[model samples]
Target: MIVAEKKPIEEIIDQVKDFQKLLIAGCNECVTVCEAGGKKEVGILASALRMYFMNEGKKVEIDEVTLERQCDHEYLEEIRDRIDKYDAVLSLACGVGVQFMAEKYFSTPVFPGVNTCFMGAAEERGVWSERCQACGQCILGETAGICPISRCAKRLLNGPCGGSTKGKCEISKDLDCAWQLILDRLKELDRLDDYEKIMPIKDWSTERAGGPRKVVREDVRL
Candidate 1:
């Protein structure tokens, strides 16, 4: 999942201060999972932005709404009519969501209210850890399903990058060396032989390539 953090209320207000009418938009997907851009968070931000402007003696009209997933065009269409009434949109979603909204509504200026973070998995209730770098190459088959692209500082394809000290990555001692974990898992499965295989050069063009990739199922296509 892609993680994100909400931008400061003050900054958001500044961005749309000149606009008397504003719409605070939220997403119910990854940003919601991270507790940054959910419906509730959107309301809070809307209220805060309103308060900030009001306190400055500036009259501002603000309304809030949440889309199930801003990345989808259908959900975005639901807000088309409502958005037309606003001067600008403050999307409390990830960068992708904001971009999609802008793409869908060319007349409206969609502003991002969150800083998009890395692709990661949730650790606990509020903590998320990076797992995949989306490097266009997957090496989980040989490394016991652990990704080194995001976890390892060197992104080594085979063995430790020889920079690990005391099982910690040299780039940052706080992080564990991804290769070390791979070795342990490989040993447990008696698949250490797979480690010797050389990883082929990754073709990034195939992953996110020429244009936006889409899935069209013959059974589901209209």
Candidate 2:
């Protein structure tokens, strides 16, 4: 899932302070699971903004709403009827969601309330770790299940960098070496021979280097 963290309240306050009416929008998808931008979080933010404005001797009208997903046009259209009611919208969804909303409501000022982190998994309660960088070229088949592109500090493709010490990364002892993890997994699977095979240089054009990407599945098209 896409992981995100809430932006500082001070930063958010600075963005919407001049507006008399504001809308705090949340998402019920990835942000909800990450405990960053959800229905509960929207209410909390709305309350905080209201209290701040009240304390400043200003009257601010704030509304809270959570969409099933801000990334989807169907969910975003739900607010079309009343979008003009607000001076600005504070979106608590990922960057993609915020951008989508901005594009959908071009006249409205859309502000991001959370910083999109990365595509990752929940390691434990309240702890999320990066798992994939969406590099477009997947090599997990030969590297066991561990991803060298995302897990490696240097994004090494073939083997561990010389900087690695023991099983830990050279950048930080707290970090595990991606190559080490890959080797261990391959050994367990009795596919260590795969490691000896050299991987060709990755074609990065398939990634962001080629600019924004889109998929066209003719079978799924309406």
Candidate 3:
């Protein structure tokens, strides 16, 4: 899932301080699972903002709302009727969600409440680790399910570079060498022979090199 972290409260306040009426919008998806932005977090942020305004001797109207998803057009429409009631909206969703919301409500200002990190997985409670870069080209089929592109410090296609020592990456002892993991997994699957076949240079054109991407599935289109 897309991982995100909360931005500093001071920064958030800075963005919406000029507006007397503010809406704190949260998401019920990835940010919810990560504890950064959700219904619970929306309430917490609302309370904190109210306290700040109260302490400043200023009266502010802040509303809290958590949508099923800010990225989807259907969910975003839920707020259309009352959206203009607020001076601005503080979106506590992923960057994608924030942009989507802003696009839908082009006239209203939408500020990000969280810093989008990356596509990652939760290793444990409160601990999320980066797993994929979404390079557009998936090479996991040949790498024993270990992604060298995302985990490797060097992003080497065929590697366990000389920098690796004792199955650890040169960048950090705690970091396992991605290629080493692949080699071990391959050995277990008795597919070590596949390692001898060198992969061709990757076609990066399919990735960000081509700029923003879009998927068009004719069969799925209504």
Candidate 4:
């Protein structure tokens, strides 16, 4: 899942201080799972903003709404009729969703409400751990499903890096050594011998930084 955390309220307030009418938009997708920009979060933020303004003797028009997804044009179109009513939009979505809203409403100011964290899994009720860097190349099959790119500080294709101490990473005592994780997983599956394989350098051309990559099936194209 695309794990994210809410941005600081103070930071968000700075972006739309001049706008009396603000729309706090949330998404029902990734950010929702992380509890960063779900419908409930939208209400909480909206109320807080109202209280903050009221305390300062300012009358601000703050409305909160949640869309099925801020990234989809079809879903965002539903807000077109209501969007013009606000001076600025505070997107409580991931960076992608915020950008999509900005692209669709170029005349209105758009602000981000969350910081996109990492590609991770939900470990528990309130815990999420980084698992993949989405580096445009995948090496999980060869490494017993443990990702070196995201977990290892060095991003070493072959790791333990001569820097790991005991079973912890050298960069931080709190982190488990990524190579140690790979070895343990490989040992459990009796695939320890596979660790000798040298991973190829990642081809970054398919990544977002390379400019949007797309796939089209001519057979399906009408």
Candidate achieving higher lDDT, 1 or 2:
2
TM-score: which candidate is best? 2
Q: Using lDDT as the measure, which candidate wins? A: 2
lDDT of 2 at 184: 94
Query: Which scores higher on TM-score, 2 or 4?
Result: 2
- Each model's TM-score? 0.91, 0.98, 0.97, 0.92
Clashes of 1: 0
Segments in model 3 whose C-alpha atoms lie over 4 Å from true places:
none
The list of candidate 4 runs beyond 4 A from truth reads 208-222
lDDT of 3 by residue, 59-141 (tens): 99999999999999999999999999999999999999999999999999999999999999999999998999989989999
lDDT of each: 0.86, 0.96, 0.94, 0.89
Report the C-alpha lDDT of model 1 over 1-222, residue by residue, as the tens digit.
889988887788778988989999999999999999999999899888877888899998999899999999999999977778999999988999999999999999889999999899898988888998765557688679888777887777767977887888888877888999988899899998888888776566646664566667999877
Sort by lDDT, best first: what order?
A: 2, 3, 4, 1
Error of 2 at 90 (Å): 0.2
lDDT of 2 by residue, 130-153 (tens): 999998888889889999999999
Candidate 1 achieves a global lDDT of 0.86
Off by over 4 Å in 2: none
lDDT of 1 at 183: 85
lDDT of 2: 0.96
Model 1 lDDT-worst window of ten: 206-215
